[model samples]
Target chain A: MAAIILLGLNHNTAPVELRECIAFSEEDTELALEELHERTEFKEILLLSTCNRVELLLVTDDRETCVAEAKQFLAEHNRVPLDDVEPALYVHEGADAIRHVFRVASSLDSMMVGEPQILGQIKSAYRTATQKKTSGVILNRLLHRAFFVAKRVRSETGIGDHAVSISYAAIELGRKIFGTLEGKEVLLVGAGEMAELAVENLIRHHAGTIWVANRTFERGLELATRFGGRAIRLEEIPESLQHVDIIIGSTGATDLVITSDHVRAIMRRRKNRPLFFIDIAVPRDIDPAINRLTNCYVYDIDDLKEIIDENIEDRNREAIKGERIVEEATIRFSQWCDSLAVVPTIVALRRKMEDIIDEQIDKTLGGLKHFSETDREAFDRMKQALINKMLHDPTMFLKSNGCLGDRSLYLDVTRRMFNLDNER
Target chain B: MENLRYLIILLYLASTVSYLLYLFIQKDGFHRAGIYLLIAGVGIHSAEILYATVSSGQLPATNLYDALSIAAWAIALVFLVIQFRYKIRILGIFAAPLAAMVTILSTRLPETPIPAQNIFNSIWFIIHIVSVFIGDAALALACGVGLLYLLQEHAIKAKKRGFFYSRLPSLELLDTTGYACIVVGFTMLTIGLITGFVYAKAIWGRFWSWDPKEVWSGITWILYAVLLHERLTVGWRGRRAAIMAIVGFCVVLFTFFGVNFFMKGHHGQFTTF
Candidate 1:
């Protein structure tokens, strides 16, 4: 293969200490990328430097020479034996190298099953390398194609969607009953860690004004004011209940702070507008019985967790769909890599054949008295047409089936049929 | 055809047993067998349907009963495909019996020769059928996760690793997928309901007639729509969302088989009309 191969170590192969030993800071990564690209064998090179990995996707045809140089560079920097780290490295050549890049960019090989951060990370690495002019044709094509596949996986599957978190679900419930939470006021009751996290989530959703109410009032007041909402007394439950669209009660009251009658009375006061109630307390602060009322939605902590669970399940359900897409895109990327090999071969063959035919026809017709210029031109055109018609089937077949592992037969047949070996 | 149906039922039974065994043993063999069994069942189920179509000289889209049967099979087929693809063995813990139950119940539905007409002429029928199956499959998966969430929460409360606690995906992955299923299923169901409404307007001269099926379906749609909007816009998700998803599927179950059996609605005469 004319392509450059890469060899590198990552989290999968070695522990953190070993990885840190071979690692370079972000500044040095740009410098190393520049240095590698300047070498003759390096048509392109990019260093993917992350906490878990520091892989160099380098382009060079001389695999053994590149590995030897890279090993020397790392050993001199680390002051460690090159033999000890030899087992930690993996080499990928040609199509395998291209497939590896796609998988890395898509995050199918990630520790977290469907994490999305890797794509952005890869893009940044590609950008940094490009900025330093360390990337050439091969790496440029691979990185750009990797980004496209990553985008497709994101859109086609729910892998990146849904945080599947209890905190996120608490916020989702708040948005459900209330159409727009932009200007809506939320009354957050209690200061439990889980309850606080849910409130943090709701705040992220831009729940406009938040009021914190706790037994002590002071404990709740501190967290509330930070989010730009006021603190209310526990006794002001009824008054606060009417003003807020969401009542997230997480008090450890061991009884209901918001009862059915409290909700009924509030529903009457608010002109029967929908109220979202999430009682994220073990003792249950809001009465579950209140969910029986129309336009009044009540869900306990378990329900919120269940919502997150359901989201997780749904993502798992679509996991295969995502995998199939990633796999297909992987092969598609490899095919692109393979076709690039054929271009040069085809260019060389066409030139050599045309030269031989031109010289032979010219020499044969040179000393003929009856041979006119127009006749020779017509003969050349006929010869060229015959060459195209004869070579079309085998050339097309070889290029199309390049991935089938039987290309030698086509090359051999082409040389024998054309008898172009005699010139060399 | 009857023999093929028996084979399909046998596969269902085998899968149910394997899944139940999996709940206890958590063996890879049972998991693999469960997949094969389900695939075999679906393959036979598909062949049976194709055979029925040719032998009965009726198009698969002709009758309401056949449509429900086809819809049920579709649910099973989609779940099986995803199961085989994802190696999500825990889903079979619920999906198998649910598929078997739908298949069995579909048989109970009275079969009638489809009314002679170009019923499949309009594209609405295909849309309605497809959405029903997709929604049904989503609800099946949602119910499975919701059930697991309840069990896991129960186990967490009890501090015990019940059989379910071992097999289900992490509480996070489950809750996320459950919420997504509700969203996807709800979108499909909304399409189903809209198509039903359009089809209703074409046949009955109104978008809705306040039929029991119509009323209950509208209620189901609103409930799930609330669930989805809450998850996406407001950030309501987790075990609580899962419980709602399960509850929502109960309504879906009632919508699918119960309404035709117990409730009076326009859906009852949909085949004849």
Candidate 2:
């Protein structure tokens, strides 16, 4: 019998330094898949390499030999010593391996449990494995099941609904205020990394007309060019405030970049259109007092962090629901794998019964020389009926017991009683 | 006919239950079920109105009972239109209960018959009653939207992220929908009042009756007119606009019921309590 095996190290088991050392690039993954396919021992293979984890899933008849050979191959391919990498490695076989893959695909095994990028990464890995022709029937079914389970977990549960990062939280808050971000103007108060990240998320929502305001005109222009937006000097922020709906402030200024009075004066010209300010800077580029102004909202770094923290708690609660779905799918998949074992046994038993019955009928016909052609045909028909009737009970018994805990024990007993493996 | 009216009320009550389930459970299935029930209720209610009109050789709103029934039908019909256009299923929480309540109230009132008069037979009176009822329905929805806007605004401004925060829509959408309702209601009210004057002149020999209903209707019209003027000119929107919408709806309610119950009016002949 063939067993599904998984050998991998993730962020939980390995440090970034070690994971990076063994992580395979796309070309390296393709090459490694081809190399692994060259060995007759590995019947099917797939390699999933991402920033946080490196996993190799395989199907093999000889588990011990395959595990040793795969570990050795990993050491040689990445040029890392066995002792240095062996402690970080974890291996799963049979049902454990299937559950691990399901959890990984559903993102329950991620560093951030509800993050969505890992499923796309797994899909790309599966695509590469298919292109290399390293994934066979069992693996193809398993990968597709993984995708289905992942989709079920996403829709049936709220695991991926909330934002757990700073930039995402800012966008979530902005959506609450504006109903939608489409065609809403965004002003990047400085070229700070956090503000830039928030703007990137805003642009993803189709926010219109990006404006970058920096103390230095050239720096602002450079950042604005990247977003296909216009640059403005710091002095012009008050004038630009009339049109812009959202302002993201992450400048390095010690003093406040925007004051309450400035926003107060612009609120009339802006026709009381809502203003959202995301202050990600350390010194707080936007004034806290501006939050009190009508139709104006200000969220600083701490506020964003608070929202993220609350959202993370929500995600954690939702993840419990996802785990239940994963558990149900895993049991269903294992039952399917167990059923695969039942089919060939039933076929072998029927074939054995037919061979014995046919041999006896031929021997009897040869002894009777006066037997008519019609009688011979009737004898052949009786032989088939006899074999079918004899095997029907055993086949039914095996199938009925297929989902039991001692299913393999029953199969072993039946195989022994029938002497079904004598030829092998 | 009475059995059909009972069935309509039952369907409206069922719709109210479904919408309430949707609000608390936040399920799309319940919301869809609510919409279907409301549609069935409105369809039967329309047939009932047509039946009463054909049976009596005049408009159906001859007394408080019939007028309230038509009012409920108008509100449900307008709600169906708004739900189809905006896809704002949350608004059903307000609309379904209000329709159900009005339907129940119509059944509770005693049917009083005035002396047979040619005034009730006038085409102008029919036009006046239909437009006024529909206009009142639209303004009622505006009040509901205004309440939602204030709730959402309070949730956002408080920064507490409470239960209503996620349930209510954004302030901008509520404000825009409220403004649309006001514009539609204002236009229909203007038409109703104009036709009302024509009907009054044909019957009472003058357009300006100084009746309580007429006075209150003028007051309600001017309130909405000012609201529209300010919203268009100075952009009095968001919280302020929401508050004005609610206030204007109160005046409309007073004109619809309060003037008849509290003060004598020429329109009192149309609805006897």
Candidate 3:
């Protein structure tokens, strides 16, 4: 049976100096993959090189030799002795390797648990390895399975919800209310860097027709021009409120810029359309009372912070669930791998039985040379039926229980008992 | 023929289940399956109606069962067209079950034969019934969309961010679509009332009567007219307009079935108003 092996140094195992030394640049990764494929005996390989870690995954017939050779290659590439790198490397073989890959892809084993960037980083690594043609069928299936498992973990658990930052949380809430940012109108109430970051999020989500309002006209125009949006005076905000669907307020104003009465009046002019306000200013640009209105919703800085805290707590709890999913998927993948190992033994057993039946049939037909064509056909059918009935139980047993325990032992006993040729 | 009708009803029920799954699953593949099943159901229903019309030598909208079957068919037809055009697939979670419920109710009602009358012979009466049933179906759809708008609004205001909040269309989209359905329904209702007046004059020698069906339909029409008028002139939309749309549809329901079932009217003999 082929083995899966994972060899790597991560943030926990290696210091920063070792990680930097072990890491491969993007251009170097292509050359390294080519050289590794040409020099190493590992049948299939994938190299994942990220800032926090550099991992090498392999599928090979001899796991021990593959690991030794990979460690030597890493030390040689970094111009270090094998003994110098040995203490920093962690090795996982067989089922443990599969579980580790799944954990890595799902971000469970990241420096920061539930961090979203690690999944994307791993995906890029997989893509590069695929393009290099270093990863073949076994690695391809294994990596694709990891991607699916990661996706399942993301959707089933809220690990990626509630953006960790204030501006991102505002964008997340905006999406919850608006469904999609496409064709939505946004009004940025300040020209601060935080507000600019929120605008970046909005643009990333494809928000439509942004309007920038600030106390200073030139500042607002500068920010608006950078984002390809129009600029309006702060005094003109109420008039523009009727057209925009979302308001991101982060101005330096001391007093309230948007009051409950102002929102009420705007609601009437806007025909009671849904309006969302994100007040990130320290003194609160929009009144809290505005949220009580029918179609208007407001979230101040404290509320956003509270939401972010709650989201972090929710994600911590959800990570437990995600771990369980990865565990189940790893076991399923292992079982499928075990099943693959028994297929050849079952095929050989059936072929051996067929060969014996054919020999006996030849002898029987030779003795009945004077029989008519119909009598000869009847004799051949009887021989075939006997062979089928005889082999059915053994065939079922090898297929069903062959992969369960001591697979080599079962194959050995079957070979010796049946006197079958063990060609492979 | 009865078995075929039952089979069509079962298909509608299956389509309803598929649509609910589509909404919950939120998969494009599941949604396409739902739409195909609904289209197949509509096709079977049309065949059933065609078969009935050919064999009985009468219009398919002649009695209570036939009228209801046609109404259910019209509702699914209009919903499918709207879903295709607007791409609001979640609407089927409401529309499909409604069509299935109407079909199921039609099966339970006593499908008694109607006695022949001079009014039934007129082409004007047939046109009036068909137009009125189509209008009622459209209004029913408007009610469903109006409910969706309220639910979405409530989710936003209450901060109950969850499944329905994500699945439903934007408040603006639902509000405008509901308004459009009401407008089209109101137009058809006006034509229905006018033709009913003309048919009444031809059969009974009178254009106006204080019959409960006529009075209730008049009230329903006035209610929707005020809704449209407020929306267009006063710029009334969003929550207030959505509520009024629901209220208007309720009044329409009373005019369609409540008046006929409870009060004495010349129109009740036809089993629909």
The interface root-mean-square deviations, each candidate in sequence, come to: 11.9, 1.2, 2.6
Q: Model 1 over residues B69-188: C-alpha lDDT tens digits? A: 676577677677556554456878778887777667556656666555554444676677678678878777888877876675554334343455545655545665576667668888
True-vs-predicted CA distance for residue B39, candidate 1, Å: 43
Per-residue lDDT of A252-346 in model 1, one digit per residue for the tens? 78878988887777765675555778787888988888777655667787776776666677667666676777678767766545544555446
Q: Give the number of colliding residue pairs in candidate 2.
A: 0
Chain B TM, per prediction: 0.85, 0.97, 0.94
Segments of candidate 3 deviating more than 4 angstroms: A1-4, A9-24, A27-46, A58-89, A106-120, A123-180, A191-194, A252-254, A300-424, B1-5, B23-37, B48-69
Between candidates 1 and 2, the TM-score winner: 2
Q: How does model 2 fare in lDDT?
A: 0.88
| Model 2 TM-score, 2 decimals | 0.89
- Tell me which of candidates 1 and 2 scores higher on DockQ: 2
Lowest lDDT 10-residue stretch of candidate 1 chain A: A403-412
lDDT: worst 10-residue window of model 2 chain A: A401-410
Q: Which pairs, if any, clash in model 2?
A: none
Summarize candidate 2's per-residue lDDT along B87-201 as a digit string, tens digits: 7778888988899899889888887866567778999998999999999999999999999988888776767777888787777788888888888899989999999999989
Runs in model 1 with CA error above 4 Å?
A: A1-25, A35-43, A51-54, A65-91, A192-201, A249-261, A279-285, A342-344, A347-424, B1-273
Model 1: how far is A252 from its true place, Å? 6.3
- Per-model TM-score, in order, reads 0.49, 0.89, 0.76
